[model samples]
Target: MREAYHDQLDSIFDDLAGICRRVETAVSLATHALMNGDAAVAERVISGDVEIDVAREQVEETAFDLLTLQQPVATDLRTIVAALRMVSELERMGDLSVHVAKVARLRVPDVAVPDEIRPTIERMAAVAEDMVGRVCEVIISRDVEAAIALGRDDEEMDGLRRRSFAELLSDDWTHGVEAAVDVALLGRYYERIADHAVSIANRVIFVVTGHHPAALAEQ
Candidate 1:
């Protein structure tokens, strides 16, 4: 009975990991679309959302089945629960990427942005991608140290969002109201994507070490 339960636990995590991969693919496609204004790529990102959604549902079902079948205890229970919560976070991250692509499509039709902002956008996207990727790494390896650094990466995303927000709100923002709004929305989406990654990292911390990030800090 124990061996059977262990297999279920491993199987659930295998499906959860696939959810992370789908998010990374969508994010990369969306970032390219944002940077190069590729409608074809944007459409691909938008369409690929279907895969993320399907993976999310599969993860949830697997977790629930494990809970019903195994009634996991201790670390096993914690891991399954964390997977359930983290999968939702990952799914929302994919949606944020789609939002960025939509905003990118809007911007490309109107005018070209200055090169300075492009690099910043690219950096933000890169950090966001790393955050999602690292969380999956931590999950697969059960490495608490790897999860810990995700907070620092998230701070970088926060900084990028703040800088872009200030630029858009500044009096010198000559992009007009429509473009300015699009930029702000895209920045917010990236920021939130980072936030979701942070959430998953915390979940990994809890699952691997049995202590939440908040608990660790209080200690």
Candidate 2:
């Protein structure tokens, strides 16, 4: 019976990793749609989000069952609890991807990002993609070092966001206010996606170390 319970715990972690893979695909497709103004691909991303949501719910239900039926303690409890949090983060990342797709869809044939700001947006999307990919590895491997390295990626994302703002505020700006707003929102969406990746990494750290990264930093 104890072995079965441990199996359930492993299943929950596996499901979490699965969700991360889904989010990674969503981010990549969303970026593709944004870069090329591909409304069909953007629509694909928007509709596919439901699957991620459903997977999240399933993981939550399974984790809840483990928590209640098995009454896990120590590392087992931490792992189950962390799975819950990580699933939520993965869902939110999917939502952010949908938001990017929506922006792409809204602009139709016209790209939402202006050429001047396209490089920045592209870099942000690349960083966000890299982070999500790393997150999948972190969830599956529980590599604390890899998880911690995600913080550096998050920092790079923040810098890209600031760069986007700088472009909007530059004296040569001529994209008009509407394009400016779209660029700003896109930057924010990508930045938030990276932030969620870091959050998931920290949760993994907690599961392994039994302490939050912030607390660990204070030591």
Candidate 3:
């Protein structure tokens, strides 16, 4: 019975890792759609969000089941509890990706991001993708160092967002208000994706140390 309980914990961990991969893929595909003005890719990303949602529900249900039935303690309990919160962050990240894709789809046959700000959007997407990919590794390996280090990536993403806004407000800005609004929204999505990635990393820290990163930082 003890061995079986451990196996269940392992399964939950694996499923959480899988959810991260799904999020990574969604963000990647959504960004691709944005860059290329590909409505089909955007549509696929919008539809694919259902898979992320399902995976999130599975994680929550499995975690709660483990809590109710097995009486997980110590790190096991931390893992189960953190899994619930972690999946929530992951699901929100997935939703942000869908928003980006929808913007692309809305402007179908024409790129949502004007050329003047395309470079910033492209870089923002790249940073977000890299952070998600690294966070997946952190989750799988339980690498505290990697998880904590994700803050640096978040900082970079923040810088990119500021740059995007600066470009939008520059005197040379040629895109009208509608396009500006689209770019602003897109920047927020990318920034939020990075924010969620950092949130997951903080959860990973909790699973490892049993203390939230914010609390630790306070000390």
Candidate 4:
């Protein structure tokens, strides 16, 4: 019985890792669609967001079932509880990617990003995608050190956002108000995705150590 119960907990962990992979793919696809203003690709990303939502719901159901049926204690209980929180963050990351794709669709034939800040936007997207991939590794391996490293990746994302905003508000800015808005919103979307990755990493640390990484960082 103990072996079977442990296997169930491992299954939940595996499912969470799968959820992370799906969100990572979503962000990459959304970035490609945004760069090219491909309405078709954007539409696909928007519709595909439902898969992430469905996966999150399944993870929640399984975690809750474990809590009720097995009464997991200590690390096992933390694992289930942390899975709930991590999946919520992963779902939000998918939603942010959908928002980016929506901007691509809304702009239609023209790309949402202007030529002036294209590099900055691309940097943000790259940083965000990289962080999500790393977070997936951290979760799957239960690597506390890699989990802590997400903070640095998130900082790089923040820097990219700052550069994007500076360009938007610069005296030479000539992309027009609508383009500026799209750029601003896209930057926020990318930044938020990285933020959520960091949050998941923190949760992974919590599951392993029984203490949130955020508190440890402060000490």
lDDT of 3 by residue, 122-152 (tens): 9999999999999989888989999889987
Cα-lDDT of candidate 4: 0.90
* Model 3 TM-score (2 dp): 0.96
Q: Which tens-of-lDDT digit does each residue in 59-103 have in candidate 4?
A: 999989889999988889888888898899899999999999999
lDDT of 3 at 76: 87
Off by over 4 Å in 2: 215-219
RMSD of 2: 1.9
Higher-scoring candidate on lDDT, 1 or 2: 2
Question: Where does candidate 1 stray beyond 4 Å?
Answer: 108-114, 215-219
Quote model 2's TM-score: 0.97
Alpha-carbon RMSD, each predicted model: 2.5, 1.9, 1.9, 1.7
Candidate 2 lDDT trough over 10 residues, lowest sum? 210-219
- TM-score, each model? 0.91, 0.97, 0.96, 0.96
